[model samples]
Target: LEVRQCLNHMTDIFDLIDAGVSPGRFDLAREKLKKKFGEDAAILRMLEGDARWIELWIAVANTVKHPKKTERIVVNDLRLLPDRRIQLPTWQLFHSTRCLDAPQALLESADIVIQNLLGLFENLFVVVIDQVLPALPSGLQWVLDDIPEAERDPKCPQRYLLSIGMRNARHA
Candidate 1:
């Protein structure tokens, strides 16, 4: 559920660059961008490796969000048996073009899932900062701000601010 939401948010970035791209359809967006620009486009090359992972994540998210009659294989918990062995979630892909013969555990732990999401976010941020933002009409781009002491948590140490000024400019 959360993964799906995060993917949707990520899709918004692509949509901002080119309107009419559907949310959570990064594959389609990639193809559209590649076709519009070219296969040799820098951003597309940078995003090539991320496409597979995003597809898998999309499959996992969709399977969990919209289950069918034979799609009841979402195990999402870590357990330790008396034998002292760790057991991770048994997440699998059901209806993805990735692998149709048989499905395997795509996501095992929350840590990995979070790490993947963060990695994708960082890559996207770099692409936006380097390529997308400068081409925007209003020059609107993201800014990072430190979390206030009153609202700060160890887990979340910063917040994003969308600024309308120069790149990396501190908005007062």
Candidate 2:
């Protein structure tokens, strides 16, 4: 659920940039991104590539929020471990216990989805910042300085910083 929220927040920031608003609370960033960039955009393409996991996460979040209207898609069964303590399989995002003929593959798939989502966010943020930077006021430009070192990649120092600073301020 937290992961989903993080993704949604990132989407919102992307939308805020697209709209050229001063980065306040706004709604429907994900929808805005899709509408503005279209499905063919690279960032959108990356997200579509992991659509299965995103769909499952949405279903799981809905089930959690409105259990009466949605069914839980993931479950774990407890088992006795060799150490005499009980253990449970990783929580999975599908209704079944197994996927692709393997037990607990759903968790792995979900992890991949999360990783993809993070990458997509990074890519989308870069794209949006590039589009919006020219129009931003000079005083507001200092916000770029807050970008973390990791994202300030030497190969693309100017491109990767915008998203990281905005993310740190919001998520910190």
Cα lDDT listed for each candidate: 0.64, 0.53
Superposed model 1: Cα runs more than 4 Å off: 76-108, 132-154, 157-172
RMSD of 1: 6.1
Q: Measured by C-alpha RMSD in angstroms, how accurate is candidate 2?
A: 9.2
> Model 2, range 89-153, lDDT digits (tens) per residue?
65543333222223454456567766666665666666565666655443333244345666766
The model with the greatest TM-score is 1
Deviation of model 2 at 166, angstroms: 25
- TM-scores of the models, in the order given: 0.62, 0.52
Q: lDDT for model 2, please.
A: 0.53
lDDT of 1 by residue, 1-172 (tens): 7877898887777754663367787778778779877899766786687777777667766667777765444444677868999765455444645433343344634567777787677666655554455554555555545346577466773334445656656566
